[model samples]
Target chain A: MTDARILTEALRDPATVAQLDAAGWTALLAIARAEQLIGTLAHRLAGLPMPSAAARVLEDARASAEQGRIAALWEAEMARRALAPTGMPVILLKGTAYAAAGLAAGTGRAIGDLDILVPRARLEEAEAVLLQAGWEWVKPDPYDDLYYRRWMHELPPLIHRERDRMIDVHHTILPLTARVTPDADALIADSVVLENGLRILAPHDMLCHAAAHLFADGDLAGGLRNLWDIHCLAGEHGIAGVEARAVHHGLEAAVGRALRLADRLYGGGLRYGQGRDRDMLYLRRLLARDDWGRPTRKLTRLGFYVRSHWLRMPPALLAQHLFTKWRKTAAQ
Target chain B: MRHATTLRIGPVGFRVGSDWRAPIAALNDLYRDYPQPDDGIPDFNVHLFAARPWRRVLRPSVHIGGDFVIPDAAPLPLVQGLLAAEMGMNLQMALGQRRYLLLHASAVERDGRALLMTGMSGAGKSTLAALLMAAGWRLMGDEFALLDPVTGLIHGFPRLISLKNEAIGVIERALPRARFGPRLEGTPKGTIRHLVPDARAISVMAEPAAPRLILFPSYGFAAAERAVLPSETFVRLTQASTNYVALAERGFGALTGLVRRVPARALDYPDTATVLEQVERMWSAG
Candidate 1:
């Protein structure tokens, strides 16, 4: 077994440790190092409440602090490029927010470069602007640029020609293939600008984005953290009317899934406990299984389906998946 | 007001009353609530609501009621000094999150390309920024320079170049015309205040400009000295940056791509005067 398994068992109790072989103990020490780092981050998060889910979500942040640093540099470069006698507005996303939110050194996720979303109308102009500022098109391979331009949801990624920092300029959150759309202009119109003159997505929109990310992709690799983000947003913003809109977007199942995750993984004294306890008994059966068990995969796939329930348009969609998977296989 | 000014970053919402209220309210009134409603506040903007107790909030866009407590035992000298440090950091976060493409370095633009002087704390970055600003290099923020993610152009947020005691005198003599606020006493950075450059007052917030050369400057006490390093040195310099590792996955490849496209060099200078001369030479050659 891998170190992850060994440590999980060893951390349980003295009896669990005693039951392990020497190999298991070796794995246990490695796990202990990871745990020590996580524990340190947790200690930092404890000082700040109200985000509700922040403390638990950051448990693994220390492991990913390096990623956060790269993201921040690119973010700074983007802002610098926009400076004017009257600077234009800009906004940051994800990992940048992790550190900016003052959880620095504790934000564990590694971000390659800053990811940004500007108005679609400004796309070409934005690219030109970056070029004018000494950022160059790094796509020596024309195919890569074409792939990003035609297939992906955002522009080809960019890097600072001199500083060597990277940036991803996006107009939307998910890929066009995912076929999810949120009103971009509407988000821009509703954005709140900071003293620095950059605008960021609002609370409702941020929550929707996180939930949509969870459901549209059905990739739960970051599931626990994403759910925690949603829960914290709700708790801090008050869930009062979020559930209805979430349901309208076909996100009720995702919300339920996220809540179930919080209940199962976080364990005891959770902030999202209100009105969600009723779903636990049903969800427990869904969650109980080994990693390789068919039950777990089936349950996970079901959650993915429920989250992507909005993709029910045109019954001919079944042909699309076959063609798409075939295309992916061919490309590889 | 508490509910209104609270914003979220990551999993937390920083509120104003106990943390960031005053500045948010002030900015809200100044900006007419956000023109775009869907794009709510980002988590990177910091607001100082109460002066005493020095209650301030950081990245208060999505959540509320969070506070940044600089430990009571920590070594802080000036009340505004803490604010400046917090603001310096948060300003970059705001720019980065908003796609301003801000960077952690000392910048001064000559011709179209910006000569970035970079290094971590005590590497003499802030001192260089202040010295250049005083020497009429036009300010682009002392702690960080904002770049446009798309164009790589840099902007200037020329407020003040924070300085300690000795550098204050060094800058004062370097440019006698430099304006300054009253010295802020009692802080960790050792009785600091802003050295306001004449350029900061009159410069038209300067639009984002291209960076022609990446110069990683190292200061020493040896006799006046200067050397130009290889372009590949930028990778090491870029790696030395605080946030480079954070953006590696999605943006790191791009950053590497950026360095490949630009000319980079390391400069070892004994003092600010030598730095300015080399900067002039690099841009002139460009």
Candidate 2:
């Protein structure tokens, strides 16, 4: 079995850690860390017997995860306060949403930025309010700024000067130029309000958002964590009305591929038809790490890098965007 | 990873792997006196790998990676592989160590009491700690002082003392018989040479000592001394710490307890001889 598969197996069944030797634990920890799932793995294998070294590393992981959770929630609160004057109900998305709602998918998850969905009408007002509240534009380059304003789902990312944490103010799930456009207004309308008055997507919408993020978004650099989220959300909410919701949003294909891959990796007994060769290639791209945690299959990674851009924009726009980015990097 | 080795330093253990054998060989020789980890397992893993297949042979740049990494860190040439390994291990500790309140300080223990000297790099803390070790004080650590939040004691992490540039000449002259690693020139930190602490330091490394004095020493300055207020010490220490914010409440408690219990002073001197005398006077007065 591949070293990446060892990580998947351990995540599926934490009890398998008991049978792993020193080298097994080493490779497993390295892979889990490389995939940014060490905290989730630490949560899964918390009570299991393991080597002292592994225990120490996981103990640190759990602590760091707790720190991330605190930081994530704090950033959300800060954003809520900043946008309070706008009188808009801020819909939390992805990791922050799962965390604020106390979902299983968020337990020990390493969250990076604060993502919120607001009405597209108030995008300008929200950006102005956040800028006044010490969030400056992260992208100073005018071309990239223009690109984000025109074609991206989120505003140019804003970073708090004092706290140094980034907040991605997203209007919708997918970019405007993407092939699949999830109904943003419907998403905001269907969001469930938490005790703190912040909102999160309902179960089915949440699943669809996770699926879209995994399949329709950027290169699958962090595919394992995204798939882990899918597995947890599907297990808790079940795949009952998710298909209908995804179909309504034109994301059924992405959602279907996500569920099939999650089940294959984590063994939930959810069966689907034979996955396409392209989907299998995605799986290979996700599992392209060696035993020592170095990324192998360079050509496959490059292919997916191109494919991610292709999925986001049309061929003409893709060529233009790639050339612009390549020129900028080369000039540097 | 083609060559690997593991060693325990005080409360922490490290398993270092490398694509080339020279770095591991250097580590094995320098850490010969250090004990292996308790169960043939290490608390952290450090890997030195090439960015690409051809880079491993041509130019042979070694990128420092492990459980944690600083992406975009410039690669080191293969001849400086030892420096890369050392940096990789230090990087893991700085980023991943949450078990202790890590202070970017150097520490030494004498008479069952630890003296911690913390400041910016080139502030002479490392050189002072090395000189003290030669003067019969136990060298706790030179890079980081691991403060146990629960026990409120300073644990020893007597890895190699990284002597930089001019400090190398001072230490070599002071401890004429001390074992030294290869003198690596043109590193990011100018020239650096590693000094293995005396056998006594390694033999008693696991012992933790109650911190008795804190000093902020500055080199290349006029001889002057001033008491540092706890409030200012708290802020400066926070800035000096890499993991203070991550440790959160436990870190606050430990640091507050430390400032309340221990008196701190900032010492500036024109030369090492003057600082040695000042330290001796302060040690007796305390």
Candidate 3:
């Protein structure tokens, strides 16, 4: 693997650590920590003889990651308690799902805001119930609220009034206007119920949802982590299961592309060709480094930013949305 | 901004990069006694970048960024870039630190036991801490008290005491010969100055101390002292902590353990001299 791709390789197999020096380990730790993959790094690199500075950082990362996992579970419990009375079967999503379900991906995973999915029909009821239970709209802007409600996948994110924790309540995975629209009801139907009565998207469906989130729904800003999710999920359920489910759910191309990307970047596989390899390398550069580390030049980030918007909405609506957002900023 | 430098304060390390050279020179001059990050690894990063192109060339304003960044943070003028770098480092630790439970407090140590003090702004914690250091108590830190959740010991941070407003003059008069950073006038905190911790504090920063006493000091009050109930102490400490909520259970355990084991008091005094006397009395009583 080239320098950009080595970090991912190291994450997958701890044995790759022997090739690194103090400087290399230092840089890798910074990059991993910044990407919120340090827990996974620390876990993978466990028992390896390394510099004390790197070891201390890994220790800190492991501690933080464990705290995040515990906090993620606690947040899930709180949401279950809050929404249980409304009788909405709260479907956990993404990192929170991985944590709540105790999947391999959950181990050493750093969690951010809690994300949950409910039936679009019951979204309003869930919102009201959550509001009564002390969650308030984070963005009070009328236009932003209109945009999210009408076009986007989630509610204008709600934050706990007291805890200052954020929750993203989604009715679907992608925006309504996106090119691919998976059957969200089918997803809800196939969810696996956890012991505590929380529903998580089934394993195969979980992979598809993660793929849709990375390649279909949002910008690949954090594609490394999301793709690592694919890597972990695929490793556990087998690529064949995820690929088969992808074909069943009209996401074969997205899932295949995600798998190929993750594989080509980390594994010694020929799933993807050279022309696309360069782009993935550029993306890997952006994702592997700390914020102050190496960057994916302004033009490349701008390209992805624009491409993300393009993939999100149709060209015409995209223009109007960007203009309105810019105008709002100007007015402010 | 072209020059980059690395400095380590106690356990944490920082690499500061800037687009303007003034902030770098200021950091170099002010942080002369601090150890260079020679292990070739820094735990945190601070970048002082021009918020705008024009801001870099004329009437420069710096935007703070690093591993843990807060976008849209207000920009600071070039003169205050040192403060921006310090603030950026502090912000990263507050948001991203995981090795220890972080409390917004100042502490001083004697006989291997630490005296931790916390209060709201203008409460004279910094002043009282500087005074304590002058009276032979080793300054642990002025900004953060790093608490080990496992060992229940307080690790020394020993950062420069950022004396603000009237406290600057008060500390200068109390320690007539102590070294001070350039007097920065008209800051948001009004005439800010950095007082370098004594040589012993810097050298012995790696030592850890068990917390002996906790005080909630209030400045400019009629002479009054009260015992802080454990419940009040716990709540106030939680509120005073930077990472208490983020660290979750680990934080709860560390804080509750401290409040239970350490004695606490609320001190209300009219001036630093009286507070110093009260603190000494409290220490003796403890």
Best by DockQ: 2
lDDT of 2 by residue, B1-286 (tens): 6899989998888889988899999999999999987566677889898877788889899999988888888889998999998899889889888999999999999999999999988899889999999888899999899999989999988989999999999999999999999999999999999999999999999999999999999999999999999998999999988889889988999999888888999999899888889999999998
Candidate 1, lDDT over the whole model: 0.50
Q: List the residue pairs that clash in candidate 3.
A: B1-B18, B1-B19, B1-B20, B1-B21
- For each candidate, what is the lDDT? 0.50, 0.90, 0.82
lDDT ranking, best first:
2, 3, 1
Candidate 1 wrongly placed segments (more than 4 Å): A1-74, A83-88, A103-110, A136-144, A244-256, A267-332, B1-286
Instruction: Please tell me which predicted candidate would have the highest TM-score against the true structure.
Output: 2
**1 or 2, which is superior by TM-score?**
2
Over all chains combined, what TM-score does candidate 2 have? Answer: 0.96
Tell me the tens digit of each residue's lDDT in model 2 across A102-155.
999999999989999999999999999999999998889999999999999999
Ranking 1 against 3 by DockQ, winner: 3
Q: Give residue A284's error in model 2 in angstroms.
A: 1.9
Q: Tell how far residue A187 is off in model 3, in angstroms.
A: 2.0
Interface RMSD for each predicted structure? 17.6, 1.7, 2.7
- Candidate 3, residues B1-286, lDDT tens digits: the string is 3667888887888888888888888888878888855366788777889766688989888888877887778888888888888888888888878888998899999999999999998888788889999999999999889999999999978877899988998999999989898887877788889898899898888889999999998888987888998889999999998888777788899999999999899989998878888989989999
Per-candidate count of clashing residue pairs (backbone under 3 Å): 106, 0, 4
CAPRI-style class, candidate 1: incorrect
Best by lDDT: 2
| Residue B281's lDDT in candidate 1 | 78
